[model samples]
Target: MNNKPLAERIRPEKLEDVFGQEHILGRGRILNRILKSGRITNMIFYGPPGVGKTTVANIIANMTNKRFYKLNATNASVKDVKNIIDELDTLFSVDGVLLYLDEIQNFNKKQQQSLLEFIETGKITLIASTTENPYHYIYKAILSRSTIFEFKLLNKSNIIDGLKRAIKIVESELKDKNIKIDEEALEYIANVSNGDLRKALNALEIAIFSTNLDERGIIHIDLNTAYDCTQKKILNFDKFGDNYYDILSAFQKSIRGSDPDAAIHYLARLIKAGDLISICRRLLVTASEDIGLAYPNAISIVKACVDTALQVGLPEARIPLAEATLLLSTAPKSNSVIKAIDAALYDIETKDIGDIPAYLKDAHYFGASKLGRGIGYKYPHDYDNNYIKQQYLPDNIKDVKYYIPGKNKLEEKIKSYINRLKGSEL
Candidate 1:
């Protein structure tokens, strides 16, 4: 009778047993090469939860003879770190130490800097994991010293494979060949996991134990059982469900359509469903895509609101999310930003753009002047009004218009300023 949760009871012990993350774990990959060399460097793993960050770290520790120490940055402090450092002279630590720090983003600047000396001297091999962007949350000095690897969310097939393995393990534990599962039920659990294999395993375990055995002495699982175990009634994970993406779509469309009432209506529906991540992401995108230069400051406001929503979370998060929705709905709309970027991308893919101007090429290198690089460059600030007309585009596409100002107040003023500078209307 194992008391541990199914996720931990059946955790992958080797890289071959680990699912997904093949980009880093696949044959002949950089991580594989490093592991083969038997020298693990300072590294950072960045990804969402349940994507095998901890599992990979465990595998690395198992492969090496080094002393392994695990600490969660959310709870562990400098004192806990000092405890490990103090043990360096002990008998078992002769092979060096591998410290797997989870949620390393939670460690503040001073706490992170404390590890600089140990990692620099190869006394401790640091494998830090973060759910957030490492470049944004980690110290730059630490980033320069470590290689960062991104873990992607598990696709449906990857999750299904894991679920199948879990079922086999459960059958072996229960010593029963009578456990039966519907294919649809299995997929339902996988779909509702939302790229998280741990969630699917937990849901499957609940569905198996909660259901009563029939007169035939066989346990059966169906869609209803999975739905109940997953609690999808409140947090709809089905992308096609009315309670899921439809509401999210309407929420963004309402904002883009400038209907504050409709936008608020959809926002309330999303908040009720407890989909704060979706609401925050869509709000941030709408603020930039729909609002644009019409109200250039809307992006910063929406960003602050999204940050506040994420920090506070749930019922309290609804306040800032609602504010962002209302602001984007009522704010003037513009598709100019998307249009300009898409147009530029299309030309890059389709056209044969010539080389960059010699003046715009990298000129800091030795003998750049010999190749005519930076020869005719004109400094804008050296001219009147801190402006100077120059040929910025490549020779082939110099006349192509990628940016066209939208007829909004801010953009109109911008167009006027540019027109005055060029002595012509754009």
Candidate 2:
């Protein structure tokens, strides 16, 4: 009967107890600087759910020797925020105050402006957390006054570690009870959790109840038991916030893995559930990034899918998406473009390959001729345009060809064009 929501019961007390985000909180990081001094400048933590934004906020308050005034932007009135700020004003002489705003994006323009003066003047050390993107929700004026830290969803490995930690906590809590979780069950819980530790632990707790048959001190969680518990399963779109990315990732992996069936399945799910137009737009990105010159039409088809979406509207538009997914998935795969561009970019980042080749430079404008922009530019229109060899690419990549066409039947023509261009001598 002593139920305090297990996640809350085991909420970490100190920074060390927190599971991840070592990048920001670890030694010599900004957080360490803030913690050692107990002086928090205005900061906004942007990320998905259960990624330790709120927990870190609390730890900073505790570590800084500052007064903590918690406010939920969702429920807090303008007066509530003002009162919290006013209280901090009174405490200015005593000690610094950390005003922790949960779901800070819910605060409207006026509400945000009210806190701007305090934040800018260092009258208040504001630590705000938001699941929604602050760039879209938080007012620009207030956002400029604060430092933003992005939090990530717990990765699969991190989730596994967290689950192991949670299991110890769960077992310790039920010291007198006969309850247990097996590896298969843990794996199932971890996979189904989609990177939310709290959800995984809760699901594990439910699974244990549903499967009460213990065998020789080991509580086995059978697939059937898990199935029964999650029979009416639903995607945790709210908690994970991977609606578009989830579908995008699935499609990409499937296309790369060459599983048209899975690609179609995800396509179906996305079309049936959310905005097909957004899905089409992402497919266009993947078609270019992943499919590339292997199937140049992949990008065109994806664009067509988007155009189809915009023109046809939903309900009827899922057809083009399905077609696009099928085409791109079954189409020949190629990341040659990805590989080539990345290599070129790596050189750019690492090397100081000089300016544009003179012939390849612009020649049309007045100052361009004076600047030696197009000293020896080639005019393909004057030639057969077929054999005119020009230095169009960067000198570093002049000989490096990135678009190795795939063996798709239609790509045959593209391959011929590539061959002609590569071997030309105009």
Predicted model with the maximum TM-score: 2
lDDT of 1 by residue, 192-224 (tens): 787888888899889888989988988889888
Query: How does candidate 1 fare on TM-score?
Result: 0.63
For model 1, the stretches where C-alpha displacement exceeds 4 angstroms are 233-425
Q: Candidate 2 at residue 416, lDDT?
A: 79
Name the weakest run of 10 consecutive residues (lDDT summed) in model 1: 233-242
Query: RMSD in Å for candidate 1, one decimal?
Result: 13.6
Provide the lowest-lDDT 10-residue window in model 2: 231-240
- Cα lDDT for residue 233, candidate 1: 29
Report the backbone clash tally of model 1: 0
Residues 310-396, candidate 2: write the lDDT tens digits. Answer: 688778888887787778777777676777678878878897667678867667787888788877776777777535667776676
